[model samples]
Target chain A: MFYRTSGQFKTSYTADMALFPVRQDAILLAIILAFAWVILPLTASEFAFQTLLIPILIYSLAAMGLNILTGYAGQLSLGTAAFMGVGAYACYKLVTIMPWMNPVVAILLSGVFSAGVGVAFGIPSLRIKGFYLAIATLAAQFFLVWLFEKWAWLYNYNASGAIQVPTLQMFGVTVAGPTASSHVQYYVVLGIVSLMTILCINLTRGTLGRTWKATRDMDIAAELIGINLMKSKLTAFAISSYIVGVSGALFVFMWRGAAEPNLFDIPLSFRILFIAIIGGLGSILGNYLGAILIVGLPVILNTLPETFGIPISSATVEHLNIMIVGALIVFFLIIEPHGLARLWALIREKLVIWPFPH
Target chain B: MDFLNSLLVQPFADMFAAPDFLMQVLWEGLVSGILYALIALGFVLIFRSSRIFNFAQGIMVVFAALTLVGFHEMGVPAWISVILSLGVMFVLAVSIERVVLRPLVGQPDIILFMATIGITLFLIGFGELIFGGENKIMITEELGIPTGEFIFEPFGGFLLLEQKDVTAVVVAAVLVIALLAFLNKTRMGRAIRALGDDHQAALSVGISLQTIWVLVWFIAGIIALVTGIAWGARAGVSFALEVIAYKALPVLMLGGLESITGAIIGGLMIGLFEKLFEIYWGQPLLGGNTETWFAFVLALFVLLFRPQGLFGERIIERV
Candidate 1:
């Protein structure tokens, strides 16, 4: 079999404990990166770049951030979009106040703001746990969105009460704002998402990740084992919100172009939650898979009827998309509660052992 | 110092200066509290019986009302539509238990919670597809609910109350009494409580999980219907009503997820206090519309003191 690792002998613990113990995973990732960095940019149409490539990357990053907290750390937060809004608004203010600052730098620094806010909100986690903590996060969700709406300065006192991303250039190439081409924007999102993914992989595999998993699996036992529950939980929140905030900055500045306070409402939070859960909560690769299914599925579904000449209205298609996504979530949970990542692992395991009963 | 005075003293001063307005605000809060209580009642029933936080409770309210309205639109009599809607709810309960909850048995709590959210989305799309997304008025008169005003003189000023609000209160009170009776007096009700207490113990005692789950869900459906009627009568039925479900979460937080009385009192406290705070302080000071997060902030503060909620069972962790 292509995935057979029988000949790949580990001579030492270091060799055995490498991130990619199997040779094939590295090869597969290289292929995907090639497609993302080279093939996709060259072949994809404007529509595909905008709808599929850009959104999937951004959503995957967002889901990865959420996965860090809920899936890894065990603290459930329903206020991800609000944190993202914090990132978006923070970035907006940064670029506006210091017009000379690099947009990319603003995006990275925006995460700092969201990380701070997230830690502030995460304090309640020390007091509460489970569904109670989740609901407490909603206080942040509602309150922050309210603040976004009421505080005019966040949107730069725009007449429409919405934040607009200004045109920005990097190396004499437009990278953001309405005038920017999808091609440049897609590359920016792609680069950030890839960087975040690598960061998440190492973070989740290291001490912080283990601490989060320990905290998530059982806080009391983790504490008994000498883990600082407060530090572990707050750090999880900070890291998770930082990544989510950057994705949010990218979400609005690169993809959305403009955003109203309503964009950061509960539905958006649920949508990101859907991506994280459906992607396979604890798995890194599941974020991309979940984002593909959640973000890419609707576009495909919308186009399928038209391609087949079904003559259905767009409204019906939209409704059907919602129903299908909802049903798919339930279906995925019932069939494989660990999510798409586990499903892939199962498939890979089978592939590794094909034609052998044992 | 001025900011602190406005924050603390001005609200009280405003209330004293306009006692009639204060009475009106309190009355409004009480009515909304009843509605919130009704919705929280649905959540409590489902959560207690099956340990699933039924996010669909809010949509079920809209779905039930829509079905009744849809039936009436189809030329069915109001009373017949009511009966028919109940039948639909029963079918929904049974189908959900059979299709969604059956295979999902023994799953993690988070998974089950997500499944209910799935149900919410399904119901939203399904409801909208059938009934269209436009807002529909509840046939308040056809349903034979009073729709008038009752004014009184209090604090040497005129205080106004809606007759519909009075009816909502009366109906909610009766429903609570009847529900309490059913839980205390009926065999099925006792079985539901048994399941809530311990599933394995209840199963060992010959209680049927599927039957009790369906029954609890059906009761939740019934409560949804009542709530839909009450709230719809106030502000027409629409998908927008679904946001009220979020309101009930803070109620569950403050009241305890499993405590019915907690839901009631918590609902009343939130509804009243949010209103009082909004009218006196929020509108003048914070630009109004504070109802969204007031309940949640209050609940979070309360949770800081009582992690298990106001009346939730005490948590005892074991290693």
Candidate 2:
């Protein structure tokens, strides 16, 4: 069998609860990491970096942030994009005000601003739950977007009402702005995403993670068991927003290079939510898988006509692509409501028991 | 001190100084409120029946409007096109029940909600593909609705009202009356209420979930069509109408999710308050377009005080 574990007996609790309890799982991760870091960067073209690698990573991070709230902490927020806007705007202000500050550090620190906003909006969450809470988060969404438009100071009183990324360098090689190469941006994105993802895994596996799970299952029950609903919900909001904010900053800085207020609107929030849910709500790895499918879908749709010598207008392709995505969401929900992560778990289970009638 | 004076006194002074303008703003608010109520009714219907928050309701409004306009463009008579639009909505309801809702039964509410969003996206793509992305004119003249404005003179000032706006208000009033009558008098309607009240108990009494779900969705579709026409008359039929449908969510929050009366009253209240705020406070003081988040913020504060909404049943959480 591919995943044979005949002699992999654990002698201690630590061994039993290791990050990768199975030897094969660790090896598989190592192989995946090797491909991501060493192989993909060297092999990928600028188009691939922009269209696939960088976007998938950034979206995965964003989805992870949402997953922590909706999936782990059981708070549904429809306003993720606004928080992202907060991070992007905050980062813009930080770098502009203190030109000597490092771009990477500025991006990392931008999350704090969103965390504050997230906590402020999350106050209503202490009183509201379920669909009502979803609508409450939308209050945050609309108000923040309005703020973005009205509060001229957020965009620095620019006539255009858009933020443009200035050329930023780390050790004289530009890492952001038009002059920066996709490869450098990709590396910066990959490094941050990987580090944050590792941290998320550990956090979700720790005491706070269990507390969140308890709260998610039933807040009343969690409260009975001495878990402070306020703290748990608020922390989930803060951490989730923090991670989401960093991803948002990276989204504009490392990927988009320029952004308007509406760039982080509801549609973008929904797209991130799609990634998180389709990726497998509470699973870290699901974000990457979900992002790949969602991001890759459009590219594949655009190319199919050319690959097969078919004649189709780009507009028609766009319409069809939307239809397919909509249909795909329904199709996936029907096939596996638990999401792609659960599907992967099922597949892995099957793989483990292959060649035998267990 | 100056900022406080303008914030508190100036807007009220402006409203009193232009009483005619005040009447116009209130009238505008009432028309938009009726439209918001109509869309929220669509949401309330689906949510009551299946506990699925139909995010597609907005797109449904757009689709219904587009279908009507599309049919009229194809040489179909206006009234016939209206009937055809109803037929399309029925098919949409049936297919949604069969393909989407049936398989999604017993899932979490959030999952069901997500499925409806998927349905919304699909319908958007499909509608855009068939109708194209251009804004089409609603055949107001062909429908026999008047196009002239009615002016009333009182206190040496004139209040101008578009005939179409009057037609929309009258028709909406009639539709709500009919809807209320239908819900109260019909056998199928009672089944829907029963299902909403207790799912298992209703089934045990031989209520057919499939039939009831299709009926609710179709009724929601009907509401969507009516809303589309009313709104299309004012703003023209386009996908941009979908954004206005989002206004219904706050109405739903303010009125209780299941209370039909709540939806109507909440819709009207939000409509009035948002308009008044935008004109008096939001425009002169805060720069305009406060209508967008005004309803949501108002609903949020209301929720902090009354979580179940003004008319919604108190939530009884059992842990």
Candidate 3:
């Protein structure tokens, strides 16, 4: 009843190609957006902001970047955190070197650096396909991470070998650094995520997106059909890296407020990949859903034992979280390889055809 | 230029200056090479049978080592602890085949790979919970493996080779010979190779997929045990040891996915070259710790020319 589409008729191509052809999806998105933009911040405690809201947004953006490459383009990458490291470092350099520039501009431009590096790494992908490409990307992960550690210049030669986000004001409000309030940081993250998501949605829905799908489904066939596999695959890498870089910037400046070299290690890459896979590959909305589940569930699990008066240690809780997440990954793959987004789509389909059997 | 000389010439000069140190590096490389070969064998065996990349092979090593040590700690004899660990790995193999691999049998290679990663995480957590997160010493003395070093004097230079490393080499050689013989002589091994060759054709011949899977995984489990013991003997048993599993990836890439010979040769080559580069070239010219990316970089460069890996079977994609 909630998703019935009987009365909705498309009169033209523009109407047929609408982002949310079903009115309910738009309304649902509006409600969610309003909550994210307004109600969550109003009701959320500092703990909620720091742990759940901020992380979910940043991770969603990061996963979206990965989803573009892995899910949409059909390339597998195990080195997302390394690309993210590229973004974070680039953003840090941009800010430190040009202190007079707008922080948001610096953050956005940082993605360009990552995009270039992403393309450089992606060059190998033209020849390396499938799991081979995935392993190849680890070269980037290990090398770039090593560079981050060895090159003191990237971290501004801090003896600590970590980047500390500096306080920066955007339109008279401190948007980053220790002095920045969570509310302001949350808004900043939200603004960037929402913008990138829109861009990602449009990109994935467009011709280039179709090209990626073609390459992903069967590269030889796609090439036979005159699709330049190189261009398609490289652009996917570029755009995906750009979005990932932006999220990396947000991850450090907006959320973490401090960063270390090992922060962008293999484990972080695996975590993002989990979000992408569990949320559903090749879906924009899936990134957000996946991030919420991957990020939020742990927080909820941590609190659940305490709330229930269980005497489980925090370390035990952390272990259980890892176990559950692992089990969930297998469960999700077995039950629905397309992930939560696909699950939601199935439910929506059933609702759209309510009171009848297909 | 001095830079060119440092990059090119000095490393060779340094190597000639200390033949004993060079020998020491080569010995270090060979031990790690054996371990890498063992891990790669585990990967090859499981991948051949089920088409799953078996990322859990790394954690299996950790889990097996932990279980052996854990059982010994619980007052079981060292030999009994080995049996108990084997039993644990058998149960693990069965559960993984049933729970994880069964449902994901027809999924894409990437999905299967991801599933293996999931298995890795779960094993890491489970092992940590049961064994605790602290590093445990390998029961070398309990197992009666000699820990003394053997010294050699050649051309007025001294070379030190640990007895355990020598034992590791001998044991690994025997294991590999036994494994190759088993594969060639056994009915089950033939089934695994047939499945790797053609899944449907093998199924048509009345070979039980589940049994083959379970058997293959169990074998991988056995290899994992040997790897755990050998690696733990050197580095101690801990979750941190899981990082070396990544080393096996480059080995697999360099060796080829389906070839056992590829695994062994690739493992040894990567091990030796990475060590040599780290000492001769990487440490002096580049900053130290080049071991972190050296294997992967070498593998990547090799893969650019041969995407199937140097020893990998040719990949023929069909639309």
Candidate 4:
């Protein structure tokens, strides 16, 4: 009832084909943008902006990357965290070693590195599918993490074996560093995430995206229809890894500011995969929704107990938070396997016919 | 010749030079193999019947061990604690079957796999809540499992074997025999095989899938208990044991998901190979710590050779 889209009409093809055809949606999105840009900077606490919002934006981007390969392409990849690690480490080395290079170019080049690695690992998909492919990808996850840890040259022989994000500035404005404010970091992540999200949506809706869908649905049928399985699968891997890599770069540089090999372990991969699953797999908007649930739930779970004046230990809360998230995953899968995106669509459908139960 | 003698020849020469050490390594690998086989068996049972991989089987091992130790700490008699732990596992199986599996009956394989992950998270939380997030030593002696060591002097070197290791092998052998008999000779076992062979056909034959699912999960629970006890005795009961459970994953990959004998053989091979690699090749060449990924890499090579695994049925793609 609150979501009624009644009386909204479009005449031109361009108008009809607008990202959000409804004027109300456009207005709503504009308000959201205004809040993010103007109000959030003024209102949100430093901790909230840095920890909650920035991490969510960065992880949502990574989840979006995994969604392209796993959700849309029907490949079950467990190496997302590894690919993200590749991007983060590559960006770190490139920017620090080549002091004159632009940060954005370093980040993009890091993504290219990840894309190359992703395609190499994705080659096994030609002979394997489903669980077999998932297992094969695990090799990538373990091997890459081990490489990062053992190869002292990668970390420039740091004794601690961890990477520190160098202070980066763009256009004389500090984008990342101790001097940068929480709002600046948040806005930078928000900008990159938004741009990537738009690009992802465009790519998934284009001809290449249809090829991915066809391959996912029925590879044999897709091949029968003259779709090149190798080309389509490799493209999905390359593009998906590129997105994941950029997200990883942004995550470390903009959010974490430091990282260890432990940060890119299998559990991290599982966490990203969980976000993709809980958030709808194929929908662009579901990435944000899923990220919110996966990343926000623990915070809310931790805080809600305190709000009720309960004195639960933080560890207990962490455990309970895991339980609740797990329960929700099972609940969502059972209730609607399509994930939170389908629920949104269902609500929109009902809204279109609200006030009269037809 | 010196390089080859030191690098390659010394390891094998050392093995044969000390028959006692060779026997000890074989026994240690066999014991570890039994535990790995137990975990792999739980996964195999569920996969055979439902074709759904239960990734939470590792957590269940931790949960079962934690429950036994928790009850024992509460002053329950050793025998009573054992019974109580089994009851706890049974309740967990029933609840999981009803809550997670029942609702996700017809869902896609990946979705079901994810739900098992949810089950994993829930079990982690639930286990921690009950047992606290700390390691606890297994009461192997109190539970009537042996703790003494057997020493042998062969090839002029002393070799020691834990009594618990011998006990593990015997118990695993007995359990395997019992499980094999039950699977082949029992009516329910045939029904389970039928269900695994074809779900719809079994349903048409009036086989109660819900009953079989509960039964299989219950059996898996029992397997978890034995695995927990054995593994907990070796390494204290903690979430870190879940890492060891990962070793079972490569075992499954090499053995195939649905084959019992395959799991056993694959477990033994991985156990022996990983240990040998870490001791001889990994320590000398890579400076050790290769055990973590050696099994997975081996499984990767095996998959490249035979995607169906060592004993898995030939996979015939329909389309």
Question: Which candidate ranks first by DockQ, i.e. highest?
Answer: 2
Give per-residue lDDT, candidate 2, residue A204. Answer: 97
DockQ of every candidate structure: 0.85, 0.86, 0.81, 0.70
Badly placed stretches (over 4 Å) of model 4 are A1-18, A21-24, B1-23
Taking the tens digit of each residue's C-alpha lDDT, what string does model 2 give over A286-353?
99999999999999899999999999889889988889999999999999998999999998888887
Badly placed stretches (over 4 Å) of model 1 are: none
lDDT of each residue in B1-319, candidate 3, tens digit only: 9999998889989989999889999989988998999999999887777778888888899889999999999999999999999999899989998999888878888788889899988988888887889999999999999999999986679999999989989999999999988888898778888898899999999999999899998999999999999899999999999999999999999998888999999999998999999999888878899999999999999999999998889998776
Better of 1 and 4 by lDDT: 1
TM-score of 1: 0.99
RMSD of 2: 0.8
Task: Write candidate 1's Cα lDDT for B7-100 as tens digits.
Answer: 9998899889999989999999999988898999999999988899898998999999999999999999999999999999999999999989
The window of 10 residues in a row where model 4 chain A has the poorest summed lDDT is A1-10
Please provide, for model 2 over B1-319, each residue's C-alpha lDDT reduced to its tens digit, 9 standing for 90 to 100: 9999999999889888988989999999999999999999989988887888999998999999999999999999999999999999999999999999999899998888888888888988899899999888888999999999999986677799999999999998898899888888999888899998999999999999999999999999999998999899899988888888789999999998998999999999999999999999999877898898999999999999999899988999996
The residue pairs in collision within model 3 are none
Judged by DockQ cut-offs, the docking class of candidate 4 is medium
Q: Clash totals for all models, in order?
A: 0, 0, 0, 0
lDDT of 4 by residue, A1-358 (tens): 6666667778799888778887667777799889877887888897788657888888899999999998888899989999999999999889879967777778778999999999999987887777867878888888788888888878889899999887888778777756777777788778888888889888888899899999999999999999999999999999999999999998888888889988999889999998898888888878888898888888778889879999988888888888888888899889889889898889878777787868
- Higher-scoring candidate on lDDT, 2 or 4: 2
Model 2, global lDDT: 0.92
Write down the TM-score of every candidate. Answer: 0.99, 0.99, 0.99, 0.95
Per-candidate interface C-alpha RMSD?
0.7, 0.7, 0.9, 1.2
Candidate with the larger lDDT of 3 and 4 = 3
